[model samples]
Target: MKKLFVLFCLTSILISCKKEKTTENNDDTGTSRAHSEWNDFGLKGNVKSTLEYTTEEKKDGGNTSSVRKFENQFSPDIALKFDNKGKLINKISYKENGNVAEDIVYDGKDKMISKRNFTTATEYVETKYTWEGDKNTIIARRFNGSRLLDKEVFQYNNGRLVEHYKYDGNEKQANRTSFSYDDNNRVSEESYFRNKPTMQTRLSIEYDDNGNKTSEIYYDKNFKVISKTNSVYNSYNQMLTSQTFTDNGSLDVELSRTYDDKKRLITKESFEVYDNSKNKEEFEYDQNDNTTVWKVYKNGKLVSETVYKYDFKNNLIYQIVTDGKGNEIYNKQIEYTYDDNNNWIGKKTTVNNIVFYTSRKIEYY
Candidate 1:
């Protein structure tokens, strides 16, 4: 049920971005770069398709004895295909038994149009999307086979998402949410109505001169304050601290952060007022700005620490974790084989004496 709710929220949030003018040539390739999920994958080059899989080393006497155990043991776990413009078109995930577990399809514009999750050879759960003007997803519907389960509808005003409605399988409205923006075009208030005229809860937001969110106050239907959160920022507009208070004005939780001269976060701390408990995390970076060490503390005592090592190409090669007493608990080492494009095609990872090999097959345009 939680997974389904998350999928429902993702379908609605997909169209929340404000519409922007798309150009004919946005990249150096001179092709109109339509929306693509490839950017999120951190993949480089003009990729046409990718097949990824992993194999675990065969253990003997509770320990890996040789790398030869991994040979000829590969099984395709995921396969993805992209269009000429590098837009994802289709993706398939394989189950452990080598059966297709999920299949997803995207339109030429890179918008996900359909996703089907197979529960058996014949039964499946499917979600379909409908788009309106400017690639706006207007409706999303989920179905268990031929029976509808739920549906979401989105409304936009001047390219800004202004309202969202959820409906059950019977097409009866379940809930509605509306948004109001301030003069800066930022969302100033959010109202949620649970199939009622009065909002069940409303959140009011305020921003500072730098356009940073400064406060958020939540109120009940009777206009009574429920909780409030406030944030403070430094001159660089970096968040310094945030505090949340209950309706009675008692501090509930507080979080603070410290940054280095380069404006990179170096330390973060959190405190719970009622429990009187605190936690902190500190980080150290190398000359290349890569994190070298990370430490976690509970109530000012070290709990865990991790050390990182990277290669000249800035690829993480090794990392080790230890407990408070400096006893090694976890260790990972990676070896990479890159293609001419400097993209890793194969990698081997060793974790606590256990080995796993991952390979990627990439095709360029």
Candidate 2:
């Protein structure tokens, strides 16, 4: 579910970026990259992102806000970097100190044929990539500690993703997902599989005269409406509002959107966590659609608040999770310093000021 959702978002992002290529790779070994799923799903491999820690001083001297304490993150790096020929190139990774971790070779278009994590010593993971053409047809990401976590596949037609299947080794017959498009070359339907069509949750959609989504619905095998969503759009094709209904006919989620004069997303108000027991929480965003801050309330009484800050790379730099007393409950500070080797490093994080712990990471091939 995690990989699938990520792939779905990447596909949309790729399409939005308009840098996507059209090519398909057909291979039986499940290591090809010619399918649209890679563009949609992005890459699948045992990847790693390093985390580091340190300390510093805060304005209020009561607690040690200046240092990072406890738990530095460490993982195997496994990301594919391809070339123009659609062949896999080098697999890149980095350490916490901004050092070379690993550099694995790829075929063309940067599809990783093999990955070696850090001296092959004390390693817990490895991955292999395969492709047919420009599309990533299949791949496997594995970790060898105790057991396997996930494995998945993508099916494509020409240069478009048609289906995706995932297996947890245990689940209801490998959760399968299929995609389809309309004559306008726009996605028309997406179906979730529970092995067979008889066990499917299908989502069907319709477009309006302006190419804006008009209605979206979910249905059970019996063709009964399980849930539905309705959207309204302005003449400029900007979404004005969207509301979703649950399978039980209750409001599941609601969103109100607003755009700037430039039609860019300026603000969005959302409601989630339908506990019915707890007051439905609300969220507001900034002009950039960035969540500057959010508050949770219980029956009009504020409970918690979270604030965010982003870096020049648009990455989350810091987050403060606090109580209404303005007293800090939990906090996170991050600094990512990258290198040119495609291997990353110098990424830091600080947590729990009371108990100070600092950690660092450095990766090697």
Best by TM-score: 1
lDDT on C-alpha atoms for all candidate structures? 0.75, 0.56
lDDT, candidate 1, at 305: 79
* Candidate 1 local lDDT, residue 220: 95
TM-score of predicted structure 2? 0.52
For residues 1-365, write the lDDT of model 2, one tens digit per residue.
Answer: 34433332343222222322324463222445454233431222212223334433354656535432223333322344444333445546555444446656666434556554553445545555567777776655566433445567788886789988876734334678889999877778998878675547889998988789988999987778998899999989988888899877788877777766666655556665475433324444444445556565554566666677665434455667666678676666666665543223455555454322334343322
In angstroms, how far off is 349's CA in candidate 1?
Answer: 1.2
Query: How does candidate 1 fare on TM-score?
Result: 0.81
Best by lDDT: 1
Clashing pairs in 1: none
Worst 10 residues of 2 by lDDT: 40-49
Every candidate's CA RMSD: 7.3, 11.1
How high is each candidate's TM-score? 0.81, 0.52
